[model samples]
Target: MFPSTEEGPEDDSAKHGGRVRTFPHERGNWATHVYLPYDAREEFMDLLDTLLFHAQTYVPRLVRMEAFHLSLSQSVVLRHHWIHPFVQALKDRMASCQRCVPRAPLCLSSPSPPRLPFLS
Candidate 1:
């Protein structure tokens, strides 16, 4: 079955800048995020394939992720006018941090975290 196309009430939180917006849909604005990148190898691909196969049996609509990474920040909405400055700030901050050394796949867990194996 297809999902509904009905629209909901407009969210005014961004205009007020009260709560941090998770998903922003303002026209001409883009969501930006920082992450620790990883190169997925054959073993990791195989594991993901196996997991997706099993998951889809229960949730048929589940789709495999095309890319994966460890997010360092929450999704932040960037207006068209602020994109360059925001990116430059991120670049400056990243340049100050020591290069990251990719570690073996770690099983990260939190009391309420999503159940999944994330590569560090």
Candidate 2:
């Protein structure tokens, strides 16, 4: 899935890999969007992989995650007004995912209450 210098650019991917292989940064823009076209799966996966890679290697403090989906906590004002609905939506999504893809891999982390695994 990645380039190996020893294999050289002349290897199979050299001719087959599309334009993204030539300019990886172009994929970043698409990731920022709320929705992306299905055709962009490869690009999106590449972007996600890159994001996780940097988060793990550079920002190790975040306990970097590989799970793609994310849900932000509501703003304090909105939370007070719509906490129940927001929780329901989040629960529904999680339940649906759990049913549809049981045992699917996911990464969950809490940065504020950090768990130092190596400490023990």
Candidate 3:
């Protein structure tokens, strides 16, 4: 990780901080790994809450998965020029990566019963 001009320790500056990490996981050839900067976790959660709240009423499965899930709806609030393009690009990327387009119905329902969050 290199440093950027904007913040924190030289090693933790924004430009360098925003860099994402990727590696091949030993678990499987198809399993690529990603590690987001630690500081971004909280911001991610904030955005997640906003997305979940906005999508909840429209997606019953979302309500069912409330305990743990990611709602891509937050992408809707990204720069106006980016919204549709980003989604389309994501779809294209997924299609190429998976080697086939998935035809299953979109479902957000949890596969298992909800579990309580661990709080300390």
lDDT of 2 by residue, 31-98 (tens): 11111122334666787778877877876644323344432321122324455664565556656543
- Model 3's lDDT to the true fold? 0.40
Cα displacement (angstroms), candidate 3, residue 12, comes to 30
The CA lDDT of each predicted structure is: 0.66, 0.40, 0.40
TM-score result, candidate 1: 0.60
lDDT of 1 at 10: 82
Top-scoring candidate (TM-score): 1
Q: Each model's TM-score, in the order given?
A: 0.60, 0.22, 0.22
After superposition, the stretches of candidate 3 with alpha carbons farther than 4 Å from their true spots are: 1-65, 70-77, 99-120
Reference-based lDDT, residue 7, model 1: 58
- Model 1, 36: alpha-carbon shift in Å? 4.0
- On lDDT, the leading prediction is 1
Question: For candidate 3, lDDT tens digit of each residue in 15-120?
Answer: 5334332332221123211112223346657887789888877984453222343332311123445456555765565565433343552556532332211110
Across 1-120, the per-residue lDDT of candidate 1 in tens digits comes to: 234765544878656434556565766688776677767789989998999999999998666666778866556566899888776766766676777565665654443332212211
